[model samples]
Target: MSQLTTHILDTSAGIPAPGIAVTLFVLQEKEWLQLAAGITNSDGRVNNLWEEGSSLPHGLYKLHFDTQEYFERNFTASFFPFVEIAFYINSHAHYHVPLLLSPFAYSTYRGS
Candidate 1:
């Protein structure tokens, strides 16, 4: 079993992306269900999406980041209103999903 966590970096600004809304979802059958939600802290990290130290069951998961609001607040133009990264969890290691974001582009990967 493993728990989920995430962070966002504004690649264009070279800083942590603060205050962005992030949500975690699990795919069940054909529907996606929200499991946890949180806004990024000043450090752009959300480590406690669920209970700390508790493990999530193995399944397909998604991380949704609200980029539109972040860019709007910063008075910057953006191409993506939001971003979603979906991946599989089938191991016993902790999951760290990180987002590298810019106004017109973004990327994500399994992190440490």
Candidate 2:
């Protein structure tokens, strides 16, 4: 079975971006449909974006992070209201998407 997970690190504060909302979507036929949603935990991770025994089909997927709310709660000014990471998941393997975030910038990559 395949699994999907994510982590969000607040680079500016040097901590996990806890309680931040994240939504997962699958692109199908030119439209995006919500597959799962989770909030970052104390460790700045969402370990189970998908069910344990479930697997996602090979396709394009996206992770949307609500950076505005996170920044607002921390009383910081942000240039990006939100961050969206779109990537391809092509096999029955675990996908770890980690986000390195700051008030003004963010980056994401495929992790082990």
Identify the candidate with maximal TM-score: 2
**Candidate 1 Cα misplacement greater than 4 A, ranges:** none
lDDT of 1 at 109: 78
Model 1 C-alpha lDDT per residue in residues 1-112, reported as the tens digit of each score: 2377899999999999999999999999999999999999999998788777677789998999989999999999999999999999897678899999999988887788
lDDT of each: 0.91, 0.92
Worst 10 residues of 2 by lDDT: 1-10
lDDT of 2 at 111: 95
What's the CA RMSD for each of the models?
1.6, 1.3
Estimate, for each residue in 1-108, the C-alpha lDDT of model 2 and write its tens digit: 239999999998999999989999999999999999999999999998899988899999999998899889989999999899999999999999999999878888
Best by lDDT: 2
> What would the TM-score be for candidate 2 when compared with the true structure?
0.96
